[model samples]
Target: MKELMDFNFWEMILRTTLAFAALLILARILGKKQLSQLTFFHYITGITFGSIAAEMAGQTDVPFMDALIALVWWAMLTLMLSYISLKSSKFRVIIDDEPSIVIRNGVILDKSLKKARLHMDDVMMMLREQSIFSIQDVHYAVLETNGELSVMKKAAQQEPTKTDVNAPITEPIYMPSEIISDGKLVVKNMRELKLTEEWVMKKLKKKQINSIDEVFYAQIQTDGSLFVDKKSKE
Candidate 1:
């Protein structure tokens, strides 16, 4: 009882609070990433941050300020690398790595699988998750930087739509391109769609939207129709 009473309880409390606060602030500063979207680098960084915070909270011999400084240093280094990666494609490739084409034109690339450190069973499991039963159905299978598998089915295996069967002359169908998301303009997508800011503003005006900030999302359909969703009050 005496030993328990003599323990620096107040100091421990203060250290814990400071460490937790630092963790929250750093997490916010680092920005949001979904668990499914976490890359290898992100996973390692998360573990390191948690370990540092735990040490600061539990270890009394180490100064709190020193631990805090270490935590901040790691975060700053990560941010600097992220900035450099954004500016230089080569740096980004070196850090985050490029996507690998594991399967092309219904043929699996053994070299790519070996380079990605993935086995046949792993690829098969990913294919099953994508609703593909056989490798013959796959036209292209790209292993993304985030470790997600993107599979494209072969044309022969794809189901024909109503237009394909009924129309005398069929036209290529285009996927809807997003031009705005979370009240921010997607300039690259707008350029790809061959749309101007003036045109977007005119469309918004027709929808009684005064500013781009009022929109939650906006997309351009294949038929040249503009779909707009206003930000909800909730």
Candidate 2:
């Protein structure tokens, strides 16, 4: 029993306990953003802590002072990074994902939506919730980091902008672009435009689009039209 509770064993236990306490303290100080704001740096920090804590806790024969020193080092590094993000815009960008404009001129920016991992349906739903029944009403839309959509309506749609205008109105045309379907091109859509693969090839060639693999999304409208967005754009 005495041999089991030797200096090394006691030291290791003490170190483990102290390290755990320090980690708990730091977690509390960092607050809930550690979970809510899951940025690149936060992910890295979490993985580092988990790995080191596990290894250090298992080292039953290591000196308590050694574990304590390591814990302090990690804690200080994490706190420093957090402080840098709070104070520096450059650092904040590195850690957190930035808001991107996903809709421009009433048309969804396919590349931006792809980069943000959002679908057109999701964006449209957000728009509907914002009291926008048609995409034409939106001048700009941003996908915020919190997964919320911020929208700016067209001047003619908003209250103040419409108050001064008394122009005649036209029928609302749904300008939905049938760009892609099931991760493949809609051949029917091509036929509707009286277009062929030849025309698509021509447009692709103009944009230096050498292969269909380059395109992740494409849209077509009631008008003879097509829009291809490259996977590499993101």
Candidate 3:
């Protein structure tokens, strides 16, 4: 009985490994878009592949050949969709939705938002993440193919260009930081910086920062200096 059980365990492992390898190869053939910049159809293909892989992994009776066939079917379907989307604009529109102008000339287009099934709150959050406080600052805001917002600010609202300032060019700010960010660490940072928690607390005490939660971003520059940017806990 023990030998039989071990045989079953080994079979399961072998099948799982094969399924994983097959998925990886098929995914690579299907293209890198499977992992990034996914469209609506790409998302559906991912879900289908995941379901098929799970079934192949858990069901011992399912043949490895069957799994391979299913994977081939999905890959063919993905190729067909890609070909159609590339060859015809109408098919591309059907497969991957076109970019919608959510904001044009600093005016929020309610019709575009409704068509895109996005809300004002969602728009506001995206704007905030882009460091845009007011809609007036935006010249055009496009909802991209990957479901991300691409923002273009008005000329006046953008960072001061040389033409705007009518000044001579100077050296641009060069980033020289090895550690750009350290998020929420009480012990790890102490070890990394070669300082105790008590010393860190003392440094924070000078700036009236009582806790780590007050800091949203912390960076260590090449000069062995630390810069802290804190956000309100609220």
Candidate 4:
């Protein structure tokens, strides 16, 4: 127990705290898409940062300053590359690969599939995930850099939009905001919508809702309509 007791707890705590802070800062600098829409290069960078940070957090023999410097330098290099990529289209394509057209005009491009290192089974599975069963249904399928297959269905297989028909559009801009959830009023939404409790009560009264408790859920539509769902007594 002598060696265990002799271990510098305070030093370890400082290292962990510094490493965590550095990680948070680095994550912010890297941007939200680092995890969300990750490319191959970014995926590797994320792993590298995690491994280095993990080592610094627990490895007492590893100097904190050295680790911190390494992390900062890496982040700076990443940012510099990102800036360069933003300026040069060629560099951007080199850093993050361009999307490949795997399928064109309802025909699978065998060469593209081979270059992307994807099999026919992989393509079919991706299509199935997107609710596409028949390859004939797909007009075009682009293999994204992040490994997602973006399929465009043929005209006959696609769903018709509102513009396709001569239907009257009610609201050009439609955004639904929740005003009440689980019998509780969302004050922030109410304030943003510039709605008073009296206004809500009046709307509720119109629907024969006497109390907020009656509402299990409620939302304000873009047309200034209140959609109130009453709690089921059952």
Query: Model 2 clash pairs?
Result: 178-220, 179-218, 179-219
The stretch of ten residues in a row with the least summed lDDT in candidate 1 is 166-175
101 Cα displacement, candidate 3 (Å): 0.5
* Residue-level lDDT tens digits of model 4 in 54-118: 88888888887788888888888888888887666568889998788899778889999999999
Which regions of candidate 4 fall more than 4 Å away from where they truly are?
Answer: 1-6, 166-234
At residue 154, what lDDT does model 4 achieve? 69
Write candidate 3's Cα lDDT for 1-234 as tens digits: 999999999989988898898888888888888766478778888889878987787788888789778878988888898987766656787888877889876789999999999999999899999999889888778897778898877656668756759654332221222221223543433564565656555666777978766776655543445577787557
Model 1: runs farther than 4 Å from truth? 1-7, 34-37, 156-234
Candidate 2 has its poorest 10 consecutive residues by lDDT at: 169-178
Q: Which ten residues in a row have the lowest lDDT in candidate 3?
A: 172-181
Candidate 2 vs candidate 4: the lDDT winner is: 4
Model 2: per-residue lDDT, tens digit, 64-147? Answer: 567667766876887788888776655666767667888777778889989888998999899999888899888778876667
List model 1 lDDT by residue over 61-172, tens digit each: 8988899999999899888887887666567779888778899778999999999999999999999997898999987788989899987676566667886675354222
> TM-score of the candidate numbered 4?
0.67
Global lDDT for candidate 1? 0.82
All candidates: CA RMSD in angstroms?
A: 6.9, 13.8, 18.3, 14.7
